[model samples]
Target: MSSEHERGDKKGQFCSIPAKPKCGDCPHPKDYIEVCKPTGWFDHTFKRFVNAKDPFTFEKKFEAHHLVCVAPVTQILLSNDGINSVIEQTKWCINNKDNMIAMPLWGHTVKWYCEVEESISVDEVADVINDAMKAPKFKNIPQHDYDHNCKEGYTWEVEVEVEKLADKVKEQGHKLKGKALEGKLNKLSSDFRSRLLDDRGTRKGGTHAAWKLAQKEPPDPDWCQPFSMASDSKVSSKGFPVRVFNGQVAKWVNRIAKAISSGV
Candidate 1:
């Protein structure tokens, strides 16, 4: 029988442990897996938060040593199954509503939090570490108000558009009364402002030039007639009627308006 099979038989399970490399110098997967297990387990532990699970219970029950115990299991899961599965499983844990709300046994919840905190995309833990490393004095110092200078003119125009759009949309039987509507308008305005800024700065002349260069002959649809509305003039395309007034564009406009008003 193969050594690997023999080892598996001894362990009493068909586990996928890698063979240790010869020459006493090569790094074994087992060692690396062991080392990384804690991080993976921690990731799993925190995943509970996303599903509305009470993480505090698990946190209280498991001391630091327990974290160490689950690390290898986490590593094994991650290596065998893949990260996406890990993420999905954790999500399932969080979404399990049938369990006791006070003290859930959902392993998935803990896993999800750990993944979010330590995972490549969210990296909450890394962000915390980075924030901690930053000089505390820097927090007190005011940030450079570059947006005030660069976006002041654009912001005013956008705000006018937002107010106009809000009025227009309200007239069209869309409810712009609630906080949610206001928030949507604000976001729409901000998005419009950002698009305008980007268009004006980077892609304005270049986009035209590129289009001109790409054409084999004269354009099929004449470029002289404006193809689309400018950022401030465009109505939101969001499906929600209320959101049309207070989406990304409106938010940006509001910010600009606030900045301008504060300055004055």
Candidate 2:
């Protein structure tokens, strides 16, 4: 998960220059150096994991090596600075590319992967872009700090909620194991995942209650980019702030839940 950065912090700053240089728009020398691609596109992603002992069976769609937890598919930003500074400012981001993704009972192993499904530009996915040409030169705006370390104990809160349900089942003299336990746990966890991953609540015209007018808009861009972080001090001579998106660090919260319930 990502952490929130307090405003005005130097660590939350990002270069103000747009990804692409506009002819008359940018006041800098027309030949200014561009380290990042203005309209870069990704064509593939990679994923790797070890087999799990007691995987999940409820969501067949999410099954992997008998484990319920799996890495989410996302794009990576490869920078020279050893993976920090780039997206750490954003909230809800993973802090490290390679780390143990812990659940309530156990930690699952995962490898970094990158796959870009659509051809989108940097301007398309960036949260905000400076195109007005009125912003200051050599400016560093504060980015939302998303370097929260949620890899471990991410499901603690959710596990507590499920524990209550398990106790109720126990009070009824029912065995909270096998399919019966799996069914109940599945509904709760599935719903929780949906709420966490859903974006409809944040849309402009939610539910399409009323029609809105707008000019011919380009294809809706894929803005879901996952970021990882590095230390604060200058780590590389290259001076790049952002690093490539390592594989997603997904938590298998369900398998652990079952383990805890059955005392495994």
Candidate 3:
């Protein structure tokens, strides 16, 4: 995630000049530079793991492996610097031709993924992406004194092995009602993945109500996406000044994962 210079701490701040400038809209560009697109649209995304274990019996349309997704959940920008950082990051994805997705309310591209060669199996995709996150570029962002606008030191990402999780689900027994299985997988989602689907897809009055309601009613088959959990959820607000979002480095990351995990 990127950040902006604090409004109060306007030390080296300049008016945000918006345009497709060479600066790529970085908060305060040291020099005009452009983010390079990667080799190809597929290359831009780092294909993460997919569940290839025993198939989820609930659905026959698409197998478990086909439905399981491992898209990277880009961090939320709590500060101005964070905002700038995500903007730059999204630019990098677009320039690189990756799957750049913009979400509601937040108003920024927050998720990215890769498409592996057709020959690659789900397990292989999982292995490759899991390894890729460890690269120098994808490693966790640590807060530096100069990262002035970040709420905390840095945002961290979690790599979930869908196949392994699926294996566990099988071990736990798959003979369950649609709702029971959905609940079981949902519990796992809360522990691992981003809760964007849980919040936006299942809620009635949130920003994406139309999109959520458009889907078929009742039990959601996709365990990894929205778990078909009910709304009535109350999201606890965690602003920057709020202690819930202060101090500890990973505090905000955890809070973000939890706040969005409404259905779970």
Estimate the TM-score of every prediction. 0.19, 0.25, 0.18
Name the TM-score of candidate 2. Answer: 0.25
What is the lDDT of every predicted structure here?
0.27, 0.23, 0.25
Whichever of 1 and 3 has more TM-score, that candidate is 1
The full ranking of all candidates by TM-score, starting with the best, is 2, 1, 3
lDDT head-to-head 1 vs 3, winner: 1
RMSD of each: 26.5, 25.5, 24.0
Q: What local lDDT score does residue 113 receive in model 1, on the 0 to 100 scale?
A: 26
lDDT by residue (tens digit), candidate 3, 1-264: 233311111112212222234234334332211222212221222212234585332211110110111221222211233233322222121111111121211101011221121334444543443354222221121111111122321112121333343344345554432445334434444442233333423344332222122222331223112222111232222232222222231332244334432312
lDDT of 2 by residue, 50-159 (tens): 24596543211111110111121011111213222332222211111111111110111111110111233434422222221122110111111111223322233343
| Regions more than 4 Å wrong, model 3 | 1-97, 106-200, 204-235, 238-264
lDDT of 1 at 73: 24
Query: For model 1, what is the alpha-carbon lDDT of residue 72?
Result: 27
Best by TM-score: 2
Please list the residue runs of candidate 2 whose C-alpha ends up more than 4 Å from where it truly belongs after superposition: 1-43, 46-153, 175-179, 199-264
